[model samples]
Target: MERKNHIILSILAILLAFSFQESRAESRDSLFFEWYTTTNMEPWKSTMEQMAAERTPDNYNQLFEVVLAWYGYIGYCLGNDKEEEAEQYLETGWKFLDELIEMNPTNAAPHALKSGFYGFEMALARYKALILGPRSVSTLKTAASIDSTNIHYLVEKGNQMYYMPSMLGGDKEIALHHYKHAVELMISDSRYHQRHWFYLNTLVTLGYSYQSTEHIKEARKTYQKIQRIAPNFKWFNEEVWPKFVEKYGTF
Candidate 1:
């Protein structure tokens, strides 16, 4: 009877622990959604700090936590023209990312993100562009080759193609193709993409890519699509759409 009781207790303990992890993951997702909708960086920074403090094992949810933290702070720093500050965060992010990659070398997500990190590093130090640029492409190509349907890989490749210098073969057409393909893939898997942080981001990316490529009608349609889904998304509604509508009007 005691042995049976012990086994039952062990099963209960395992379930409780799993529940806790799921709760934490849900909390992180809510916080991330807030950050995305509002563009308020406090929750983003706090989440990164919390993840750093936890130093948790790289389970799927926690791995996403690491990625969110890594991208949030470093992207914020770069956008705010704080390259020096971004370097410190980048180093920390790279450490965590590398550890995750080492532990799960077969995981395509980290490889895709690592490719973006290389781009971010180049952004921080353009002098190293010649060295890191091809690395960024190769890393992403490897990631995509591993999983051709990986939305993250597709999006990262689009970013690389769109942002790389024309001298280095940046083609807006390639960006459009990749972005459109990713969006299509995401829509095909609503369970996978619904409320996924990057779903909205990819749509925004596509909209901007269309604008830059002079696909004015497509750009306008993209904006309308986002508006339909998230009318209250502050970043898109207040900042992105308004600025876009200023030139294009309510289309």
Candidate 2:
């Protein structure tokens, strides 16, 4: 009787672990969609740690998404002053990214993602910027050179260009060129259908790039385009655009 009870308890624990993993797997696609669409972290609040803890090098692209998702979530945490949480995500994200690049040494996308992660590290520890800043730029440029036409690479490069200060080599004009080329690539390519997360994400950044450069008219037009395509994008619709309207008044 005692032996049977012990076996039963062990089996139950194993089953519970498997169930948790399966649940995370089932929710991956939906949570990803919501992350970029709703831009709300509510669904992801409890999953970041689980996702990172389970990170494996088996599927290169799968691990890539985990790290990228971490990057996104970490950004939100940093912006909201959740320093401790952001640091945890940042450490795990960088570790996974390193593992990814080790396995896929020449992969451009991972390198691009690495560059972005470096930015997050710099944000959390400004003292590290001196070393990480140039590394960030070079890693991204290497990614772009490896695959100039990749929309993801272009968008990330543009992000670096658009957000970094001019003193640090960020130029809004150059960023615009990268963004316009990305938009053109996305439009002409059939792989990214309308409302695809990357598709919409590219446009969102392009809109912000326009705003940063004081091209209000172009920004408004971009906003209208997003409204037409992804009217329910809660991040832009509920938060970003409304704030823009409050400051600039709607077009």
Candidate 3:
């Protein structure tokens, strides 16, 4: 009786361990799915780490495309200082985007991603915009048309609207409306990080818009709120405000 009882306890312990491991694995997978959908690449770095561990030839090409896209985006966010890395990933991302577009010309995702890549390149190298603005604008329009149901595509369009001229139908009011719509649609997603990022970006955009229209007090409040929320935020402190100061020279 004593020996049988001991054996049962040992089996229970083993089962518990297996269950815990499986639960952790599922949690990780869920996290990655959220990141991939929301375009949040920071914490999703672990997914790339896992891909590196299982670098099979059959999966390598797809993995490379994703990695390039993520890195390209990350470097883009890092601002003008990382120009070299940004350019490298921009090139890599375009190649992959082109391949994906060729494979499925009507697929909305590739066009959306391509539009973003071009926009990032324009931010990093202003001259690129002079050359590629028309192409990027066309691609973004196609992306929105192709994926009328995806809020992400709409949000991408909203972002493009901010930079485009009035002749191109880029209206700040329309952009704000769409940004609010995106936040409403995606806020309840289990992806907290992605939601958080969207919130932050929206805040920044709103703040800048207020500043642009001479709402100095409102912009100052927004900037102060950003500092309070993310005191060490990379772009907010370093790149964004400096550019603002340079442009208005007293704001």
The C-alpha lDDT values of all candidates are: 0.81, 0.79, 0.63
User: Of the pair 1 and 3, which is ahead by lDDT?
Assistant: 1
Per-candidate count of clashing residue pairs (backbone under 3 Å): 0, 0, 0
Give the number of colliding residue pairs in candidate 2: 0
Per-candidate TM-score against the hidden true structure: 0.87, 0.77, 0.58
Candidate with top lDDT is 1
TM match of model 2 to true structure: 0.77
In candidate 2, where is summed lDDT lowest over 10 consecutive residues?
190-199
User: Model 2: how large is the Cα RMSD against the reference?
Assistant: 8.0
Give the runs in model 2 whose Cα sits over 4 Å from its true position: 1-27, 45-57, 187-198, 246-249
Query: Which of the two, 2 or 3, has more lDDT?
Result: 2
Better TM-score candidate (2, 3) = 2
lDDT of 1 by residue, 140-246 (tens): 87887789668879889899889877897899999999999999998987423546566777898999999999998999999898877667788787778888889
Candidate 2 per-residue lDDT, tens place, 1-251, comes to 99999999999999998888666655675556566677677667566666656766477756766776677778788878998989987877888889888888777888888888888888889999989989988898888778877776787788888888888778998998888788988887854555555677778888988888899999989888988887788878888899889988886
